[model samples]
Target chain A: MQRIVVLAGGIGGARFLRGLKSAVPDADITVIGNTGDDIHLFGLKVCPDLDTVMYTLGGGIHEEQGWGRSDESFAVKEELAAYGVGPEWFGLGDRDFATHIVRTQMIAAGFPLSAVTEALCRRWQPGVRLLPMSDDRVETHVLIDDPDGEGRKAVHFQEYWVRLRAAAAAHAIVPVGAEQAKPAPGVLEALAEADVILFPPSNPVVSVGTILAVPGIREAVADAGVPVVGLSPIVGDAPVRGMADKVLAAVGVESTAAAVARHYGSGLLDGWLVDTVDAGRVGEVEAAGIRCRAVPLMMTDTEATARMAAEALRLAEEVRG
Target chain B: MQRIVVLAGGIGGARFLRGLKSAVPDADITVIGNTGDDIHLFGLKVCPDLDTVMYTLGGGIHEEQGWGRSDESFAVKEELAAYGVGPEWFGLGDRDFATHIVRTQMIAAGFPLSAVTEALCRRWQPGVRLLPMSDDRVETHVLIDDPDGEGRKAVHFQEYWVRLRAAAAAHAIVPVGAEQAKPAPGVLEALAEADVILFPPSNPVVSVGTILAVPGIREAVADAGVPVVGLSPIVGDAPVRGMADKVLAAVGVESTAAAVARHYGSGLLDGWLVDTVDAGRVGEVEAAGIRCRAVPLMMTDTEATARMAAEALRLAEEVRG
Candidate 1:
């Protein structure tokens, strides 16, 4: 069986995992989900990225929304608002609140995030070993011109993305605790033992970028000596979904498929897949010393997404030779 | 303004407060709600009795259930169960979870329960100034014959009342932290300034008894130089609502209106109101050096409950004379 390790973010990563699972049902997949977006809302620990992946693969995700539980109710959010407690910008529904509540309780009882994620997956049976990028708190903070005026202020990434709608120009995207964060129990081991590693079509700056920001994760994947393939979240100078361009600019990278592969660089990434529209840039990426292929990267549906996953695997095989 | 102070429990107290508010809309009512019944579930502080009062007076309480919000969804609870994390017996709904979440957040932020209650009441506008009996954690634990057999084991009052359905013989009802707990802010002040103090038809053993267990509270009311009147929860020889009889048995009190009034005694209680069905016990109670009256005590509706509150006030007047 193929040993696969995938570093993931929220919606985009979750949808990609769903397709990856379809593409290789027998593959031993281990996912290291971004924890930079993990937040404490109403005293409950909410791991948005981990939950998105779990819900998506477990068949509980809101298909159209690509996150949260299907057929969810916002009674909990409404009640919180009624109590005059807010940050009501992020949408956490009742079903989703339960996951956070359970997680918070476990963390309070001294269980690590990875262990809690494993326990939660027993219910979802998300078909792969799901681990948080770190057991330690590693929130992503975006530096932007203070919305209330004056100099730049660092806002939580979720607040910037969900609340501000990424309207403000991001000065920097910092994974606040990543420097001190150790890879959650299985993360390094998964990479070390893996036959292949893949980066899904997730936000390079905040999603996959945040995971790589963890001190040792990027180094481990680099030394693992396995074919490391990545699918471009950017297509034809734009993100397929989400405001990848805004954050890419923060990191001084242009919003192009070629620029993203180069951002990961040839030292870490062995192969890179760009969209058919960005086929013209394939040479540009390959010239940067990473093997490159042009594929239909739009995850329009599960089948299309699975095909993209297959293409990424094929590129990994080509780079292996 | 009457400047009435009331000692209260959960559902029964909340319902009575609704009536009390209706009876004297302009009265400076201060409710010192029982906190011994407070339980921490899912890492969230759940003040069942306090919430009951808030939701009841705020017009959000489930009319039929007399606790939680009307039209409340149990999606959070269901999801928690799916994760196999629960006591499962407590029926906390989605809307109710929000109250706990806000409260837990505030408490974790170092706010005392009293301050949190005050903040919550601002949203609830419970008409009356609602105060917790104590700021400190004072969970009620019931000592019961171990369900798994052998010697007596102590369980949280909720586990006994909700999970076990109060089936196991309760040996003792202990207000775990009352020995060291001070009256929450405004509790003693309310009692000191009151023209009259009332004990609504709440559980004599677990509810009213728990408030009295708080060291200075009972003394404050007794030394307040005001008429302190109480309504009997027992209609005939049974409680109007709740399993008050079971808990009363734990405290070695007979499940009778006369016994309950006698339990309060003439020292702390200057007057008592028994239901019309227990009218014969009125003379028996009066002979014990406390003013007693027979009145319709059934809180069948808000109007009926208001009448009961009015009757209790009337008895306070009679006692003062």
Candidate 2:
């Protein structure tokens, strides 16, 4: 089986994987889930990015919401609200609690998150081998004034996005403990042995960048003989989804496809995929010594996303040749 | 100000509290909650009895179901099913996840359950000071063998009742860890300072009995130099709600008002109240050397429950004299 490794963010990455699964049915796909967006909500371990991938691939995700499970109810959410517990804006459903509960329990029982994730995957069966980038806690915190009238504080990523609705300007984005976090077992091996490594159109600074922040993962991918391909999250000078531009600004990066290519550079990139809207920037990205290609990267549906995946694979093969 | 202590179970305890709040607006009401039915489900700490009380008093409880929150949905549960995670019988809603998340987080963070309960109560603000009978983990497990399967194993109180629908014949009931669990903070003090302690018509074997099983609480109530009155859960020869008969049988107690009084006995009982249907059994209960009375114990609504509370108080005064 073709061993394909994909680095992923939350919504788009998950959605793209659904398409990739269809495109390459026999491929041995492995997902290095970004834990940077993981949050401890009401004590439940909520890996938004990870869950998105799990749900999208397992065929349980809400098609419209693109984050939580389909056919979800808010009984548990209301109960928590009645209890006046937590950052309620994130909208955790009753059935979703079971996932968090099981994950948290296994984690508390000294199971590494990767193993716990495997146990969870036994149920989700997303088909792909899903591994958290690291088993250790690596929360993405944004520097912002405390919304509750307190002084400036580092808030969890979900609180900034979900609770405050990402209203404030982020001064800094820190992936806490990423410096110390070793790649989860099988992560380095997966990358090293991968036939091709692909970066989905995830937020570069927060999602993919945070995974790279973990020790050893970036180096392994760079040293691997396989072609490392990255798709631009920036399309037509803006992020396809979420507040990626705002986050990019926090890291002093411009919201442009060319800027995203420069951000990954040769340290991690051999091939870069950009949207057709920014096709003119291909020369600039290629001049930076990374092979660049323009393709229709709009994942409006499964077919579109699968084509994008196939394009990425085709580009990787060209780079290898 | 009246220092009132309430011995409570689930729905009845929470509902009675609404009226108690109305009855004595300025009084200090301390609720001693039953944690016997507490169980770990889907790796989340599910305090069904406590949640029922909290939701009821906090006004988030489903009025129709008499448990869980109203307007609840099951998206999360559906997602979990897709993941193949379960004890599929008991429903955990999305809004409900917040409670478990907060609770599990607190418990994991080294806070004992009483402090966690208090912290959770801070949000719900269920007017009354709510206290779990014990801080230690105490699970109510029922011994039963599947009529269709071989061997006997103790099932968690919830699984045996809610999931299995109480179909199996229960051989015995055990409040696991009751022998080791110390009374939660302020439980004994609350009992000692209480002007009156009234037991709502909750299950005798599982509700108040579980609280009594915790060391120091039962003794404190017995020695508290105040009237201790109880409303009988038995309406005539049967329990008003729940599978109390099954539990009673497990504990080797018959389903009778007289037997219940004897079960509580002289050490813990100062006053006993049976229903109108069991009015003739009051003499038999009083003959056991405890003050006994018969009144309408049916709590069809808040008004009926308040009246019952008043009658219990009246009986408490008689017992005190």
Candidate 3:
């Protein structure tokens, strides 16, 4: 059985994993989810990226919204607002709050993040071993224009993405605490033992980049003798979904398949998948010393996403040869 | 304006307060809510007594249930159970969760319980000043027969009341931190400056009893030189509501209006109100040096309750004379 490891973000990463599971049902998959975007709201631990993966795989993700739980009500959120307690921009449904409350309680009782995730997964049975990027706090703060003054200031990634809607120009993306943080248990082991490591079509800067920012994780992935493949979140000179272009520009990368692939570099990336429309940029990505392919990357449906996953696996086989 | 101080519990105390407020619309009421029954559930501070008073007075209390917010949904509680996390016995609705979340967050940010209660009341605008009996952690633990073995064990007050439904014979009722806790900032002042202090038809052993257990509160009320009056929770040789009879028995007091009045004693209680059904026992209470009255103590409706409150106030005036 192939041991597959994937670095995931929130919505896009979770959706890609569902397709990956459909593509290779027998594969032993381990997900090292980025926790840089984790935020404490109302004194409850909320791991948006982690929960998205769990809910998406567990069949609880809201089908239309792409995040949160299905048939969700905003009773908790509404009441919190009534009490004037909030970051009302980030909607946490009643069912979703249960996850945070449980997680927070376990954490308060002294359980580590990795152990708590495993306990939560017992109920979710997401089929994949979900592990946080690091047990340590690694908040992704973006340097954005200060509204109160002319100077630049740093805001949490969610605040910039959700509250401000990424409207402010981002100057830099910093994964604070990553420098001193150690990768969560099983992260390094999974990477070294993986037959293939895939980077799903997630935010290249804040998602995949934040995971790589963790001290030992980047080194472990690079030194692993497995093929490393990536699916581009960018297509047709723009982000396929969300404001990836805004944060991509912050890290001095253009919103294009070739640029994102080159940003990962040949040393880290063995193969790259770009959307079929970006076929013209295949030569440039290949010329940068990384194997590249143009495929139907749009995850319009589960079947389409599965085919994309199959293509990523085929590219990994080619890279291995 | 009459300066009234009341030590409140949950449903019974909250209902009595509604009548008191109605009876003396211009009175400045300072509620010293019992915090001993407060419990930490799912890592959030749950002050059942304080919230009951707040919700009941602020028009949020569920009228039929007599606690929590009206129009409440148990989505969060249901979800938490689905996640296999809880003491499912305690029913916390989504709307009520907002209050605990706000309170836990504020407490985490270093605000004392009193300050957090004040902040929460700001949103409810509960009309009267609600002060916790103590800012300190004083949990009420009841010694009960352990279901696992023949020996006895201690469980949280909520567990004894809600989970066990007070079915297990209680051996003792201990206010765990009362011996070390100081009265909250305003509690002593409220007692000292009060023209009258009223113990409503709340549980004598755990409600009004817990507030007085706090180190300075009982002493302050005794030294205040003001009229101290009480209405019996017992009626017709049983409790008016709840399992107050069980906890009353734990303290070796018979479940009768006269026994409850004698339990308060003449030094602490100047006047006592027994139900009309217990009119025969008023003479026994009067023999114990407590000025007793047989009024309609059943808080069947707001108007009836107001009349009961009026009777208690009238008795307070007579005691002063």
lDDT of each: 0.92, 0.85, 0.94
For candidate 3, report its TM-score.
Answer: 0.99
lDDT of 1 at A260: 94
User: Candidate 1's residue-wise lDDT over A212-236, tens digit each?
Assistant: 9898999999999999999999998
- The alpha-carbon deviation from the true structure for residue A86 of candidate 2, after best TM-score superposition, in angstroms, is 2.8
Q: Estimate each model's TM-score.
A: 0.98, 0.87, 0.99
**Residue A159 error, candidate 1, Å:** 1.3
Candidate 1 lDDT, B46-104, residue by residue in tens: 99999999989988889998888899789899999998888788898888888888889
From the highest lDDT down, the ranking of the candidates is 3, 1, 2
lDDT string, candidate 3, A1-321, tens digits: 999999999999999999999999999999999999999988998999999999999999998899899989988899899888888999999999999999999999999999999999999999999999999999999999986689999999999999999999999999999999999999999999999999999999999999999998888889999999999999898998989999999999999999999999998999999999999999999999999999999988889999999999999999999
Query: Would you give the TM-score of chain B in model 2?
Result: 0.96
Q: Compare candidates 1 and 2 on TM-score and give the better one.
A: 1
- How high is the DockQ of candidate 1? 0.91
Per-residue CA lDDT of model 3 for B193-257, tens digit only, reads: 99999999999989999999998788888888999999999999989899989998899999999
TM-score (chain A only) of candidate 1:
0.99
How far does residue A62 in candidate 1 sit from its true spot (Å)? Answer: 0.8
- Off-target runs (Cα >4 Å) in candidate 3 are none
DockQ of each: 0.91, 0.53, 0.90
lDDT of 2 by residue, B118-215 (tens): 88778777888999998898998888986568988888888888888778989988899999999998998899889998887788887888989898
Candidate 3: what lDDT?
0.94
Instruction: Write candidate 2's Cα lDDT for A1-321 as tens digits.
Output: 899999998897898888788889999999999998887777778888888898899887999988887867676666666666656678786656668867877787889999988988888789999999999889999997777776788888888877777777788999999998889999999998999999999889888999999999989989998999988999999988888898888888899999999988877899999999999999999999999999998999999999999999999999999
